[model samples]
Target chain A: MQAIYEYLFGAASFVPHGYCLAWRPDLIAIHALSDGVIAVSYFSIPIALILLLNKREDLAFKRTFGLFALFIFACGVTHLTGMIMLWEPYYGAQGMIKLMTALISVITAISLWPMLPKVLALPGPSQLRAMNERLADEISDKNEAQIQLHNAYSQMEAQVVARTRELQEVNQRLKEDVQRRTLLEEELREKAELLTATNAELERFAYVASHDLQEPLRKIQAFSDLLKREYENDLPEEALQYVLIMQNAAHRMNKQTKDILTLSRLSWDSIKFASVDLAEVVEEVEFDLAERIEESGGKLEIGDLPLVPGDRTQIRLLMQNLLVNAFKYRAADSTPEVKVNATLHERGAPGTGGAYVELTIQDNGIGFNQEDAERIFSIFQRLHGRSEFDGTGIGLAICKKIVENHNGAIEAVSSRGEGAIFKIQLPTSQPTRRNNDAGRNEAI
Target chain B: MQGVTKRFKVLMVDDDPEDGVLVQKAIASAGHKVDFQVVTNGAEVLDYLFTEGRFTDQSRAPRPNLILLDLNMPGVDGFTVLKQIKSNMDLRRIPVVVLTTSEAETDIVKSYDIGANTFITKPTSFADMIEVMKSLKKYWFDSAQLPVA
Candidate 1:
């Protein structure tokens, strides 16, 4: 468009000075081409502007189309005035037409600058739609990110509150535990004091009982001996019977006193544990009871024995007592047989260390009923009459006491007329000082 | 009980009078004459031995060659008296024998540790007491040599 403006101005400058320049053939031919172009522009540009105005409701197009219409009208005026200059060639007609042409060209050229920028800068609908979609996606993405950040912040706050609550609960529990422990310690001290007083009382009572009973027993025995020495032949059978009965009663009382003493002594005895060789202990027990075993025709068989921590004297007493019971209660018509076997057992609740040694002493004797199993270990608790079985009923009780003192367990599984099996499980290690290794747990 | 004692004095520390009479009879029946002096508690024994309080005259309270100590007594037990006697250089030479019903290991060990010459668990029957007295007499008076006090 600028190139066309430059071409028109160059042709207008060629007219001779003060002559009828508009009448020149070159100017006339240029004017004719300019007139035709302006007419075509007047029709075509308005039609194009109206089409645009019809498609869009933007009011900016109305002003733009108005200015373009004015450009076409001015060009038409310039072409008509040029024809007037050509017919009136002499006088100031030529200068006046040239100045008017220059002025109209300059105005048209300035107006067209704004139109070209508007036309080139306008975008297609597809491009505009794509840009709108991109802006919408960016806003939604930012909203999603903000929502995620808010959720994460709330989660962190909840975690902090929960952690603080847990800490407070733990602290409260610890305080309660300390209070309970103090109360327990006070209770334990009181119990210890009471036990001391009770022990002293028991000691005094035992002393008085033994002394008073023995003093009367001494007089009776002395008088009886004197009677037997002085009037044995003269005394009647009934009198002698009376003396014997008296003597038996005295002996029984004496035995009862000794048993009571033994029972009391068991509590005061010191516990001494060591690595006891079970195999040797069994052999010695069997050999010691050889005479009774042989008399009962009992076959005593022992399996492999494992070493365990225990008091040797107590263990020996325990084994001796069990063996004696087995031989004494043998089946009437059958030869008694006893089997002693030992095996390593996994540590249970009452047991400690890596493993425990369970020594099972099974006897093929006349076993008591299952109901009598627990009763058999009670002191002086007899299942049969004295004539049926000769026992102080203390042996099994002593064995049970000894096993318990060693921190072990003993149980008897038996059925009437079958056999009794006494199972003893002892840990390989002795019980250690509980608080010495504070952080360590017992090896299970 | 008075007639049973003729020669050697027997000091009996017992709370019950019946028990004291029984011991006097048992000692007498053992075919030995003893001068019986009965005291209810361990304090009386100490008084009689040291000639203090009720027994102020040293000549009437004869020093015994053998002392029969009971393990349990009211107000200062036999063990405490035994400990006092053993710890005293002048009194340690006297033969102190423990005759008590309690055969508890603690009592036995403590009695022995306190320098008791012999420990005898009291029998429940009278006949056994006679035998215990006889043994006590034979072992303490004859077998064991007495140190002149």
Candidate 2:
């Protein structure tokens, strides 16, 4: 133990290394000064490595760099020992530092070999610059696309209105014919098909709306279109006029069939009750009518509405009908504005009735006589000549049926010039829902 | 149109001859030179597509790029025809457009559920019909998407 201690720390019994240059002052000074400069420079390299490691905690080879710093610092101390050995010859400590530096250098070298691929994999500056450029280009392209879409939509809207007006006014004589006297024998036809589709008790109307009568009318319109396209220049003017009338009448009848089909489908299918959000329903209706509203230059104001237990589809139809009627009957000079507002009212008779929602749809348009309010909802009832406004006249009637399906009541009041107001009251929840059987699937 | 070399083939299944003529005229006026063929009933359509029963002659029954279907027919209805065509591996790629007078939502939903590519209500006016069919021309000319073998 004594010998080992001596081997590691003893500095006695040895001459100073200054003897190598024969104690020349100039040579001694040069060796000490050179060692001093080399030690300081070595120490500075490790300090710089340590500073770099501190700044870049995310560096891939952090431990290896730390090991390099330790070894480089050991090298600096070894060089300092070299400067000191000139006088004191601390050979044992010098040997110890050199041995530690060798161990650290070997470990750092081993660590670096394994990390070569990882260090190389790090993204270079030019690659990072390209990625940044690509990301910036994508953002700008997406922004440009959105702007172009917005522009195209408004342009298309303008084109649609202009083209439709031109099509309706294609023939001066046809325009006069469209305005002629009144609707066809719609009342008589309605007495049969109208009651058939709405009255679930009537089975024959279901067959009629789905087949036979509609097919012939559809064919007539199709062939008339074909004739007009093929023989517009060849046919006599009178023949072409007859063809136009046939096309017009057939088209109106087909629309009536569609309305009847809608009613019949309601009668055929069972209503599915759900948590119907009236505000959302009104928003959807507004979206569907957005184009029409734009063409009419109209506005719709919707208010907060309570959720009711009813069919969402039926509610949508009811709102659509009223809103369409409002737009269709707008005063030629005025911009139409329709407002939908609702309130949740307290239950009636306490235990006897559940809560109900009362809704009011009001419009600014050409209104009808108060006396005809009741008649307007009847099937096939039209308040104006087809010339003034073209409609199947079944819109209000469908609205009435939808209201009825929800176990509700709908009524309208209007003066000749004052716009109409439709008041609706429906139970907040269906009473039959408590049985749970209705909630479960059952065919109508 | 720049690279096209042959006329696009469209097969229409309709019972009404007038409707057939109307669609043919509409396609012709759209400036898409079409090899328009019409079959009057559902049975003929099945035969025309599968080359079975009356259309055994392969040369007479060339595969169409598109099919225009009408739901109402005398024998096997359009729904059956659509189901058969969509289920067959050989015929499933041809796009089917349901051209019908039925505005019933059930028909629309059922046609889509059965794999009809498009559903359109039969138009009432020549101008509107042209407008309705403009997209059909667009679809026909989209050669990259065409399943033509």
Q: What is the C-alpha DockQ of each candidate?
A: 0.22, 0.34
Candidate 2 chain A: minimum summed lDDT over ten consecutive residues — where? A434-443
The RMSD (Cα, Å) of candidate 1 is: 10.0
Runs of candidate 2 exceeding 4 Å displacement: A1-207, A235-239, A287-299, A330-337, A349-352, A364-366, A369-371, A431-444, B1-6
Cα lDDT tens digits, model 2, A292-394, are: 9999888999988889878888889999999888887988889999999998888751233767888999998888899998999897899899999999887
Deviation in Å, model 2, residue A420 alpha carbon: 2.5
Q: What lDDT tens digits, residue by residue, belong to model 2 across residues B32-114?
A: 67788999999889999889887999888888888999998888999999999999998999889999977777899999999
True contacts kept of 2: 0.60
Instruction: Report the lDDT of model 1 for residue A344.
Output: 87
TM-score of 2: 0.59
